[model samples]
Target chain A: MTSHHETDIALDPELMAYVDGRLEPAKIAALEARLAHDSDAREAVAKWRHFDNLLNSYGRQADELPHSLKIAALERELASKLKKQHWRAIMLGTGLRRIAAGLVLFVAGWGSHAAYTTGGNMLASASHPYFVAPTLAGHAAFKLAAYQGAEFDGDNITSALDWMSQKMQHKIESPKLERLGYRVESARLIEVDDRPVAVFYYRNAENERVTVSVTPKWTEHGNYALRVVDLDDGVMAYWSSDQLHYTVVANDNRGAITTLAAAVQQ
Target chain B: MGLKSELHEHIGSLRRYALVLTRDPVAADDLVQETLVKAIAKAETFQRGSDLRPWLFRILHNTHISALRREKTRADAAPDLPEPIANDCQHTQLELKQVLSALDQLPEAQRNPIILIALREMSYAEAARSLDVPLGTFMSRLGRGREALRQIVQGVGRGKLSILKRKGDSA
Candidate 1:
């Protein structure tokens, strides 16, 4: 801790500590002795007290500012949000959208683009236990939501994916389903297990919402055949590679999913 | 108290702190609102037994800061001071306004420390952790901030100045 600032003779830290009840016993006696003799030091101490007192008075006065209406409205808004989020959690939706900034919901405007459309089927007929995280299954069971406050580098699909790749610190590119008749809708991040999971939402000709969630870390049973995940709400096809687990949850059916899954693998 | 009420308990403090940071009630409440939405949205991250004020303060601080950075990127970024809602506040204390104006003059780097330690009454260590800065850096800013505020007060010499003039001058 600095004993005194040589550059700036503002409030002495010793006095600051003393007023804050943080001065050491060793320094208190010496500080008091000096305070008895040094009128300038006494003024500095008084100024510190005055500053604190002024702000303290300001705090009390500020309470009279008509904040209740705004705060009540805010509370109501938050309560509504909490109710919705609480229900979403009950419905197995993403319970939390991690980044909390007081800024406007920065909607990054990005034009859509087509990605790879591979015709080959890579379903790996051998089913590998369908081992995915329960949360991923939970995520698939509900509609995938893009974090509304997501800031994207959405000049184009490539840049958006590049940005998300950089944001996630993992190589995330276009899901390459542009040719499969799925245009890039919106891409964003949601927290799972207190970790950021990049989810890309796309819509098909039928306006079916298709989401590809890229969660870090691999599950041993990730290399499974593209089978429709059993969810009462929707159909999902999942696969994984390297350290990334990819799950595509959609309101579409089996045949559409098979093609989508095959195309996603490309 | 339940987590919701516990969070509610800090709303007043959050607003007051927001006012200090932005000097605008609209912006301050917005900061508080965002912090609450975030706190509720991600309540799971907050453990039950740990301190809530620091946790909430971190959210508000980070929220305000990130918002500023994002605003800087925009072509039509707002001015430094937004003609604080307090202007309508017939009860605006001259001394407090001077204090706020002095605080306004400090860079956010310095302003945040003073606001945290002086106004918010956060411990040096807790404030440092909340701002996610090292203790040394936080203390250095506190030292600079204290001096800067002292200078502002001395230079102004406690005179009656229209906040309108101050706003116009800063803007």
Candidate 2:
């Protein structure tokens, strides 16, 4: 009898099955018997075992896979989505005039921006420095929306604000615009800057729309800042006060956003 | 529980698969996050009674592929093993890299079945269900992936052997 069988160097289908642990008990026994005396078969089995060990070792290390890195990535993605949703609300607005004013502030504030035309709705890039919210509440709201069970419906401004304030245990109010020609169109509790913030859509008589988004200020000095951008179609007026940030967008009405910002200040 | 909760349960697995795919913690997370976002956005489109894990895997795999295509580099090409997983696969490092690179080279068909069997530890029948392929197809792909890996490992060993022989001749 040949001590080392050299019939074929390649692994047969049956041997491959054995290597994969798919062989039946009797077939496994036969393979074991062949390996008992034949050095070639034994060497082949050792190589097969080495490969299995290597593949399995790699997979075993999966248990040590880090979860924090993935969580951080999740945070970045959620932040990006929140930013997109913030601009989406403005872009998908019902053709408001303040939207034009906000557009102006947006273009003037940020030198370069991308505006996507989507279904009769013009959306300014929320990724722009000005459009991106800085408040924790605003960021949180956006993140909440990223998960299921948080739906955004900005039908009624005052009622929604009241409900959100009550549920979130925080008082969120639209900017006091008693003197400005714009009235709050609707407000939705949204996320911006990783926090929950109320986005108030305001409108002037000509149907120009402005949005006053309010969120809990977690920044030091709790300062108020404003960003304005000018677009081909309109102007974007974004102003953040101690309490909230107001973005007034309009096409032809520069004076309206300025007037509203001044009034809200008073 | 709703689909969201059920999907959330697999977040850890998704992260692991992504880490294996991207080999970069940040990139892995991005893949998982993108997968979850897309899955949640299109949750309504998911058919009831389908395996949610595979669906999420499909999204994650696609996202990673697209990202890789855009970046034009493999995650493994990046600096190996961040602090967190630095010690995890260190013991069997060469073998691990060999298997991973071989997996990377596999076509989607062969790759999917092998991953399903090897990583997910699913049976042939279960793997077929997840792959939406017949049993025969799954078995063939599994066989092909194994054979390909064996060839790759052997080729690497041969190259090493030739290098050693050259050193001996020079000596």
Top candidate on lDDT is 1
- Model 1: CA > 4 A from native: A1-13, A24-29, A66-266, B1-5, B70-92, B158-171
TM-score of each: 0.46, 0.43
Each prediction's DockQ against the real complex: 0.09, 0.10
User: What share of the reference contacts is kept in model 1?
Assistant: 0.15
Task: Kindly give the stretch of ten consecutive residues in candidate 2 chain A with the minimal lDDT sum.
Answer: A113-122
Tens-digit per-residue lDDT, B1-171, candidate 2 = 433345455666676666666666666677777887786565555554566677666677677667877878664653232222223344356456656676677776776665555554545676676666787777767766666665666666566445545655766
lDDT of 2 by residue, A70-133 (tens): 5545545543443333334433435434555564564455344323222222243554333333
TM-score, candidate 1, first chain: 0.41
